[model samples]
Target: MQIGYFLSCEEYAPESLIQQARWAEEAGFESLWISDHFHPWTDEQGQSPFVWSMIGAISQVTSLPVTTAVTCPTVRIHPAIVAQAAATSAVLTEGRFILGIGSGEALNEHVTGARWPATGTRLDMLRESVEVMRALWQGDFVDHHGEHYTVENARLYTLPDTPPPVYVSAFGDKAATLAGEIGDGLVTIPPDADLIRTFRDSGGAGKPVHAGYKVCWGPDAAACVSTVRSMWPNDALPGELAQQLSSPKHFEQAGQLVTEQMIDESVACGDDVDRHLDAFRPYVEAGVDVVHVDQMGGKRQGSELEGFFAFYRDEMLPRMRELAG
Candidate 1:
């Protein structure tokens, strides 16, 4: 399994993200996953820079290959545009980029003043969007009229020798089957063996399966749990609410239901090396090809950030790599 660092666009500024990418590379992380979001989940987290610009900057600073943890190209942006941006990103990174995409959430898509479609419609739109992107990436003028999108005479002038791989993100069996059929890889957050099985059984065999796990590394476990509960309570929000919620305020309201015990049970908090490894073991055992770790505390900088990376480099990463071997 490849080890990676997840760049939280919602939590960090552009420069801080780039710096963290450098730190991740220096700490022996093999790749990077950056979240693409139009808004932060809560007022507390408080930052959401345009992801493509940050990716361009990241390409300049690090040799590590990067992927968006998941970008929703079906609604806020046309897939044709996403194809162009992704193609350019591939060129900028010298073909070290993967485009991870999903059906999208209301919070980002609703900003375009477009009506939020039902889940089935969104998935259908996502399928058509992928088709549109793939057609544009062929470097020919594309004319497509699908149920959800229309592209007329669109051609991506700039593209890498090989188009970046498109990884589909899924949280349920139906979506996993879609990922299996259409994606070069699969991207999901949890370590669900059943989900993995569904993907493979539905034709995703031998494809990369990627997941992200959040961790808060510090001296105090309780403090870290409190910070996670305050900053990322939305993570614990159940079901399709994450996709349907239209704003940060709604998320904040829903997050009120997330208890400290839930946060403690779900996330890896504090500096226990064994516990950190245990948090990741589920994904590894579930056959994830790559696991991206997102550090959950506030601006990870100075000694705090440095210490976390150092610990991973010296203690955690080696053991994880050995387990992978």
Candidate 2:
């Protein structure tokens, strides 16, 4: 098992993200998972840089392999375009890039004034989009007109020698099955063992499985919880609400329902190495091959980011590695 760092594009600026990638490597992180977002969940979070640009920047600073924790290509951009961007990223990173994708949330994809499709339709779009991307990656002009998307003789001129692996992110059983059917790998953040099993049963056997979670570390546990509570109440928003909520305002409205206690109970907060270890045990038990973690509110040095890197480098990461054993 390997431990990677997650770069949350929703909360930090591009330069800070690049710095964190370097810091993550210095802190002993083996790989990187970067969130791809067009908007922050709350206005208070206040930042959303274009992910492709950030990936290019990160590639220059760190040798760590990078994956988009999840990018949704179905609505906001054409798959042909996403394929080209990903191809360039792979080349920039020297083939150290993995395209992690999913049926995305409306909060990010609805900005183009498009009606958000239902979950089933969105998943269908995701499948077709992946198909289109893979075909384009084959270095040929591709023409595709499908149920949910269209491509007009598009081709990826810049390509990697070996196509970058596409990892599908899924939460539901049907989605998990689809991940197994099409994905080169699987991405699950919550450590739902049943979903991993579903993926394996549905032709995903032996594919790499990746998992991740978020934590806040600081001098005071209460302060940490409060910090996470303010920026990430969306963590507790139940059901398909995460995927269905169309805007930051809708999310902020729904976020009102999340209680501070909910954040404390679910997240690994504060400096307690044990609490952080407890948060990671589930993923290790679920047989995950790689587990990436994000530290919230870390945009600067000697701030939340510094404290988090210190704790993980000195305590959490080493212990987690042993536990994974």
Candidate 3:
């Protein structure tokens, strides 16, 4: 299994993004995946940078392949704009970029005074948006009128030698079937196994698949959980994200549900190298093509990286290679 890093460009300045990308590449990470969002999800999280601009900058600085973990093309930004930005990024990277996209959350899409559509509607929009984007990337003047979008006489003037490939993310069966039908690849956060099988059986031809899970490599598990709560408390809750979005103020309330036990289950927060390797096993066994690891220590440097790099490169990656083979 190939190892990759998932990051939020907002948390790191351009210099830091470049620095970490280089570090990750040097440390043997196969790819870099960055989050795309206009807002920080909530005020408590603080920063949200233009992910495309950051991607362009990252292309200039690192040799590692890069992808948006998942960009939402249906709202806030037009699919045409995302298509153009992706084309430009591919050219700059000399064809090392993959466009990872999904039906986004209300927290990001609703910021523009647009109603956040239900999940079913969002999935419909996603299918249509992908069709439009693929048409635009072909470098021919195109006119399209779809339920969710319309473009007239549109063409991408600047494109790479080969158009960037697109990877779609899906958490459920219907969405997974759509991703397999349309996307060149698939991206997910520790994707459900049934969803993967659905994609495969739905005429997917063994395309590339990427899945990510986070690790808070700190000495103190409780401290790590506390740190994660500071940024993403609602993530601890076990329910559909839409169910939790009834009240925006509930983010804080949902955050309170996150406890040390919850943190320990998902994240490799202790000092054991063997434990970290064990944490990543199910993903490999599930046939994931790329195993993305988010080093969730955030801004905590010094010892965090010191321990993480040692455990990951020395122990975890090697075992993963054996398992994958």
lDDT of 3 by residue, 71-115 (tens): 999988999999999999999999999999998877678777888
How do all models score by TM-score?
Answer: 0.98, 0.98, 0.93
lDDT of 2 by residue, 19-94 (tens): 9899999999999999988999988688999999999999999999999989998999888889999999999999
What TM-score does candidate 2 reach?
Answer: 0.98
Better of 1 and 3 by lDDT: 1
lDDT of each: 0.91, 0.90, 0.78
User: Residue 193 of model 1: what lDDT?
Assistant: 94
Better of 2 and 3 by TM-score: 2
Q: Which residue runs does candidate 1 get wrong by more than 4 Å?
A: 300-302
Order of quality (lDDT): 1, 2, 3
Cα lDDT tens digits for candidate 1, 167-236: 9999999899999999999999999999999999888999999999889888888988898888889999
- Predict model 1's lDDT versus the native: 0.91
Q: What is the lDDT of candidate 2?
A: 0.90
